[model samples]
Target chain A: MLKINDLHVKLEEEDKQILKGLTLEVPAGEVHAIMGPNGSGKSTLSYVLSGRDGYEVTGGDATLDGASLLEMEPEDRAAAGLFLAFQYPVEIPGVGNMTFLRTAVNAQRKARGEAELSSGDFLKIVRAKAAELQISPEMLKRPVNVGFSGGEKKRNEILQMAMLEPRMCILDETDSGLDVDAMRLVSDGVNALRSPDRSFLVITHYQRLLNHIQPDVVHIMSNGRIIKSGGPELALQVEENGYGDLLAEAG
Target chain B: MSEIAVKTKAQQTPQVTGAPKAVTALDDRLAAMSLPQGGFSAPARAEALSRLRVMGLPGPRDEYWRYTDPRLFNVPGPQPLPFDAKAPESPLFAQRDTLTLVFVDGAFDASSSDELALEGIEITTLAHADAAGDHWAAGLYGALEAAGQQPVKRPFAALNSAAAADGVLIRVTGTPSKPVHVLHRRAADAADAVWHHVIRLEEGAELTFLESGMVGARSNAVIEVDLAQGAKLHHITAKRAIDPKVGLSHLFARVAEGAVLKSFSLAVNGTHMRHEAVIDMAGDDAVAHVAAAVLGDGATGRFHHDDTVFITHGAERGESRQVFKKVLKNGATGVFQGKILVKQGAQKTDGYQISQALLLDEASQFLAKPELEIYADDVKCSHGSTTGAIDEHALFYLRSRGVPMDRAIVFLVLSFLADALEEVEDEGLRAEINERLEEWLTSHA
Candidate 1:
């Protein structure tokens, strides 16, 4: 569903490469996890893949289901079934949670040539999905994450991912600030939306989130490239042994 | 209600008409009209007019007049007011069986107004109310005078009092499910017109008032609203005056106690227009929600200058929320400054204010200031003001999606203004404002 080839991305007007010689592929009907220490460019890959501005594509290509994503806009990427769950979601005041979600979902649906959902139907689905994600009605009424706690924001991100139902999902540190209960609730939300035909690349520094939404393959990323790939056991190994041993081994 | 009296002495001046000198001569002449004598005559009017005259019209020196130049009042043409003409007509609110009060060039139009069939409501032209010994209107008029004991230094309010043909005074003793719509229309020819109105909502009464201004020539106006304890009012003002060379100033307001006052002011077209709305929160648990959207284009300047809310909280537990959004294009300008004053010992007062302006061209400009003055630490108050061009990224995002530059700009502008629009409770009024916004955007595009 998603693929990147020798992608070398850098900040606009800067020579410092943020994603260097990075390559990965998440084929349909499969799940992949990318684990790395801080500054390993995991979030950078997600941002570049999502086509956020200010990040220049220095080299290589990225595609979604065979179509080029690097050439698309951020909203276009979203319309093309690509979702990036941010580590720290942006707070957009004056834009209600329901309003923002509706715009995003409708934008994607409109781009896909599907009939837009009416306000009534949209509300029904949002309520159902929010309930499953444990997002209270009051929370959905607020401005997008305006005063939300860190864990609630993360969970709200998961709720959006579920609402969007993207073809390819990238969770960037989805468990960073979550407590045990919130972590489980967020993981459960993601796991509930998982299916054989849909693919997800959950990016995190810890292995705890992986235990809930187990990935078929785990890739160890360092220095902007994937150095090793292994089964789910590799996540547990990293949790117990830490990335210090992996860096030494990769060297 | 206690009677509030304002004493006055009018300086004698001639009322001149025609030519630039003649214009000032008339301004000075009108400025010279003495206060009308006893028994509801010139003395009462003089008191209010002179008080307004002393403060003088707002000039560039006033901080509030920084962006909107009141000097537009100086014109080299015929004076549009004090003209002899038939009463103006309105078809917008005619379809609904509303208690209609008609005012032409600030003078009450008894022949045009409709008498209400309901009881417990007193609806009459200010002329008739004044003749009927209605002292309530007198007490409320010029009540919010500046310290100089003037009606207001604003030229429009001054003109409204100086040449006010007549005004409509309405009082609701009990809540009226149906509302009274005051349609203040200007004369067709090139004559300056001025109108004044005073509306009062008695204790426990509620009403929704629709007030708007449409002027063919230069016009000035002042309107005041008082909502007694437990009274509620929803006020909507829509101004569409398209003469880029003409100017108008409006000072409209409301006062509430343990009451609610919500207002939405939309300014889409005018040569130069400024509206100052001050809502006084007097009683405990008083609430006020005021929002305004000003869409300006071409050289036809439109100013949604200021929307202010004064929450006394003297009674305790009061709240005020104000939001203002403006879009400036071509050489148009917008200014918004809002302040919330929380009185001492008035605990649990919550106040929030936000104002933003979008400048679309180098010639376009916007000035915004949001302030909070709190005397109690237990209060929650916050205010934010921002002025900037359209978000380049969001513009690019829309354009990259195949939306043309013009359409994308319109979309972003509308989205930027959506917050204020959503605050309007009336769906019809909201739709009208949105349509006006679209019209302005399309013209500029």
Candidate 2:
């Protein structure tokens, strides 16, 4: 469902390069996890794919269903069924969470030539989905992530992920701030959205999150490129021994 | 207050100098035309005219006119700008039951106004009452405006007091059944409308005054309020001129001992607009709040808005707050000059002032001047002003959620004005104002 052809990116304001010749692919119906240490261009990969500003795609190609994702605007990429669960959700002081969610859901639908949902329809859908994630009505009414806890913010991100229902989802360090219970709840929310037509590319630094979501394939990334790919046992192997041993063995 | 305080306040103010260029400009511009007529208001008009001549119209050289150019109003006559009469939205303050008083091109529209009397409130129009020899509002016709000009010159307000043809004079003896709505509708394209409203609330009485509608192509307005001891008054204005119009307005209020005064204004659009407010806490423990929410989009037409406020704590334990917020984009401009003064012996006085602007683009700008003067040893006063653009990260967050750039901007802009809107005490009125803001943002965005 998602393809990257030796992606090369650098900081737009400086000569420093962040991602160098990184390539990865995630087919439909499969969950892929990219485990990498810090400063390995993991978050940059997600931001680059999502078309965020301040990044120069020096030499690379990222596509969704054979169409170049690099050419689309951020919102257009969203309409084309790409979703990024931000590592740090933004706090929009005066905008209500529900207002943002509804605007997003309807905007995407309209951009895709689908009829917009009525307020009643949207409210009903959001309420049911929010209840499943243990989110209260008051939380939905508050300003977007203004005073949310770490767990609450992550859960809010997952709520957004569930609502957008994008064809390709990129989880950029979604497990960084979650506690054990929050991690379980967030993984459960992601697990419930699993389907044949949907794909998720989970990015994490540790294998703890992998124990919950259980990825179909695991790739170890180092210095902006994936150095190894293996099955679920590789995650357990890294968990038992840190990335230090693995990096040395791979070298 | 019980008459004595009013006399004392009158005795405290110093004299005003003469410099009324606006008066001379008005006279010159209306060489072939007749300015608004006055009868019982003659003495007050004469006093205001002399004071305005000394104050003179604001000029580029004036210290008080540093941020906003008074040249547009100083000209003999501003060019006539057409107003859109077919606006799809309903008039502001129409959602509630109000004692509606309508005016057309500065003249009182008797046919369109409600009855002259409501329970506990006596309403008199300038044409009928000012034409005669005696009236209750005569004592207050230009008294407060005269007091407001001493520290800083307000030439237009004096010009308004000197020449305003028609307006409403309301005296409240008790709590009114419904609020009063002053509705100004435009008739002529070039009507240089000027109006003055004098309100006196009796001791222990209460009233809510709502002002809305388009005054005229070029207009100057003044509303003077006197709140008696223990009385309460709420004043709100929604400037509904969405087109490129030029106007200036002033609100001068005297808050008495134990009395409360709150006022808020929402300015949506105008080519050039200025709003000035002067509040006097004459008695002990008086509380006053003044706030404004303004939006200017220079994409379709030029836009500039200015808010100037002065609050004086003359007595002990007075509390005052000033909150002003503006959202400008596409080369629009906003300006704010606010001051709080705590007099000697006004111990434990509390004053707060905050002015902020959200600029959607680099071309837009906001200018602010916040001041504080204190002679009291024990007082709490704070003032702040900030100017910033839309958060790029926040914008991306919304857009990444599928909202377009324009829509996302509107969202952030509305959020930015939320602080100013909190000044409105009534929930229903606040919601209606929000609706008006939302519609304006959608079209402008």
Candidate 3:
């Protein structure tokens, strides 16, 4: 489960408030989507929740499994079962994708006080998972996100999500640069990981992605707060009418 | 009467303005050094000393010294540093199938080294060869170094040739069964050492030469390599001395017809260091490559490293490449000066050079100069130089994946050094180098 209670944040370098008293809660085994226009503080919430720099949390708190996530570093957060699939996955020129993934898997394991996986064991699981995601061995051997297509990057991110298998996942505009076919492939990768004791806080600007990875609950966010909440029908309504009516009604 | 008059004039003009201040320093240096008493190397040593006396130490003013100041190396009787214990040699090579030659403070340790025996190879110490009188090494002694003096000045190389403390001579006539490992150890502090090594690969011969471990505070070395028709030489050097003193070195090579030469250097944690490489392709279809990967941190004290490389294409269809990369942090400094020249009639020549630095902090800095001159109209030559900070986005991306900040930085640093590491042809050697680089980065960063 993920919890955010009246979270307030601002830019550390400037006198600007990004998240103004935002509150939301996603219980276990639920997929929740947040629909918002640009500058409505959707990305800020994801960054703040993941403990990125340049954002100072002024008030309130965010928790995972009732444990405070604000005080932990980003790596520690991931070890505590939190994952963030970035909108733009980074391109590291020299670090191989397989090396990065193996390091991450072992790092999280070590942080969680578990035994490290042997090279043989790791190669087996990685190859199987990669096959399901349509990632070839060559793609896995190359540098992370270097020379990869948009869909390949998204699929790589999902592969990371699958490998880490964190309890709480945050997909920040994962559908932004993906096409319809690519979206389907990526959605299938995400849907396979959906299960009880797992939660997803999907942040998207439209309802198209929700059709592939159906959401159990939909929330409408304006400014920095969630002003509306409903079932999947809410996504359908937003897709048909846009955010203009909702923003005016919320105000 | 005329000789007496000349001696009187020389003594009287000691303070003349025409004689540069460097000459005075050179006199002090000569007084402190003596040539090998007698033997095959005596004439060459005397000749080198005469050349040193003529050129003298680098001038007091360093305006012509592109990026490094030779004043520290020119200091006479430099204060001794507290001698640190000799660091452990690379375990990767110790157990491997290689001929290990150990040197303590630049002096060959006979008892600890393996027997000088190998198929198709003749190995002997410079001292041993000198005592033998008119040996095979007589012809090669200081030959390439004297030839490398054109288009540049290396007064210290002349000094090394003249008063070398200790060195090894290797002559390869056929394929060697294993690599030759030059292992250096430091036993005293502020150890000022000069050494010269001459390696000759005969027609169709091949060799892999490895130099590793730390040296003394002030060490100067010169290696002369001669590759004949269709010969090949792979030379690799790795150093990690951090005494805040100095390390000066040069690798002068003459690559002949259809020969191939590849030299790679890895330098970490040193103060006031400069490594110069001069390679000449004298025969057609020869291939040459020189590369270095350096990491310097000023956190402990002053840290600086400079690499000066020059490659010349003098024959048809010759190819040459130079790659240098450095990682600097905590006020560390790095410099690279590289040049390539293609002679006339050297058509279809290929030359490439690239130098890059990744400054890990605002206090760190990198300076570079890259040049290419081609007299052949049909040659292909390109060069580039760049300096930049580490990618912040990439750092965060690695960290978010559950890798700690320290490990993530190491990964990125290795990534920055990847291009330079690629120059190592042997896969096992490259892997060992990567492991060594990772260990250094972990401890220093």
Candidate 4:
């Protein structure tokens, strides 16, 4: 389970507050979708929780499985089973996607005091997962996201998530640049990884993606705080009427 | 009596004006040392010595050496310390089937060297070749070096030409089945070693030349290569020396019509090291590529590395490229001076030059001088120079995936140099070089 209470965040370089007194919690075996408009601190929350640099947590606490996530390094946070599917996956030239994946998997394993996967075993699992996601062998061989299309990048992210199998997954705008088909494919990849031991925090703007990967709970975030929490029908309500009604209701 | 008076008068008149004390000392040392007998042409030696006297050892005031100080290399006296000759754990080119030629303290060790015979190639020591008789190598000993002296003056190369104790002469009549490996080891810790190698590839011939190991405590080396029409040469060098060594190596190559020349060098840690190369594409449709990957760690702010390269496209449709990459950390210093020149009549020429440095820490410094001189109106020439720290975003991305900080840094550094390493044509050699680089990264980390 992941929990956030009175979370306050600000940019380290400038005196600008992003997340102000936000509170949210996603228990085990549940999918939660946070719908927000522009500048709602949606991305900031994901970055801060993932232990990214340049973000100062001024107040409040966030934890994963009752352990604090703020004091750990980014890698340590990752080993603690927190995953962030970036909105714009980085393009790392000269590093093959397969090499990156294997290194990541082995590193996590080592950090968790588990045995590393052999190359042959890693290759087999990766190939099967890739085939399911429509990732070509060429894409897996090329530099990570160097020349991949937007859909391919999203699918690659999903592949990484599948490989890592983190307990708490945060998808930041995974549906932004994806088309309808890509959205379904990515949603299916995500749905396949769903289990009682894993939970997903799907951060998105529209309810279209929610239609594919149905969330058990829907939260409307505005002004750096979740103004309302409801069931899946809330997404339908917001999809029919925009945030204008939500803002009025929250006020 | 009259000749002695004239010489004294000339010395008093300061024929070498404004030369540093180190330069004068170097001249004195050269004058005192006994010159090798025979194989070398007398006139070439005299001319090179005269050039060295005029240019002097490059000082900090010299434009080309503004970033690097040549005083350390110009010190007099032989290296006082003896090098430990128990070969390194992983000697370069150890896994290859090569014609290995070992040199101990600048002297060729026949006992450790392979037989001086190979298919389609001829090899002989400079002393033996010169002692035997005048041959093809005599014509090329200092020919390309003297030609490279124009436009920019290399006093160290001139000194090497004038005072080299011993070297090798290799001639390739056809494609050689195996590569020629030159492994240098320093037996005398403070030995001041000088050597000049001559290589000539005949028309339609092909050869690969490999050089590795530490030259010596204080070493000056010059390698001259000539590729005839339709010939090809692949030259690779790895300078994997331990600390407290100063070395200066120069490579001068000329490519004839339809010939191809590819040279790559990897330099790791050293107190002070500089590798200078001058390549000329002389005939039409000739191709030349010169690349280097350098790594320097300041060991308390003493390590320094410089790569100076000048490539010329002289004939029409000629192509030339210069790629240099350096990774410096912990106050280490890296310097790169690279230029690509296209002649006026050389139409359809293509020239590319890129020099980049990744400074791991704020104390590390990188100085780059990238130049492109295009006289041909229709030619394409481009040059770029960049000095930066590691990409933080990329680092974060990697670290976020559970890779440790140190491993992430190593990965990024290797990725930065991967493009330069790709210039190596042989996959096996490339892997060897990669392993060397990885070793360096792990040790440094």
Runs in model 2 lying further than 4 Å from the true structure = B1-40, B83-89
Give stretches of model 3 more than 4 Å off: A6-21, A36-41, A57-60, A113-124, A134-142, A146-149, A176-184, A205-208, A220-229, A234-251, B1-20, B64-66, B84-92, B188-190, B344-349, B374-380
Supply candidate 2's per-residue lDDT for B247.
Answer: 83
| Model 3 docking category | medium
Candidate DockQ values, in order, are: 0.12, 0.68, 0.64, 0.74
- Highest TM-score: which candidate? 4
Q: Considering summed lDDT, which 10 consecutive residues are worst modelled in model 4 chain B?
A: B1-10
* Reference-based lDDT, residue B358, model 2: 83
True contacts kept of each: 0.04, 0.77, 0.73, 0.64
User: What is the TM-score of each predicted model, taking all chains together?
Assistant: 0.77, 0.91, 0.89, 0.94
Whole-model Cα lDDT per candidate? 0.70, 0.86, 0.87, 0.86
- Residue A19 in model 4: lDDT: 91
Error of 4 at B1 (Å): 64
The TM-score measured for candidate 1 stands at 0.77
Clashing pairs in 3: B83-B189
Q: Candidate 2 residues B93-177, lDDT tens each?
A: 9768999988898788989988877898989887788777689988998999999886778878888887888888999999999
- B-chain TM-score of model 4: 0.92
Better of 1 and 2 by DockQ: 2
Please give, for residues B395-416, the per-residue lDDT of candidate 4 as tens digits.
Answer: 9888888888998888899889
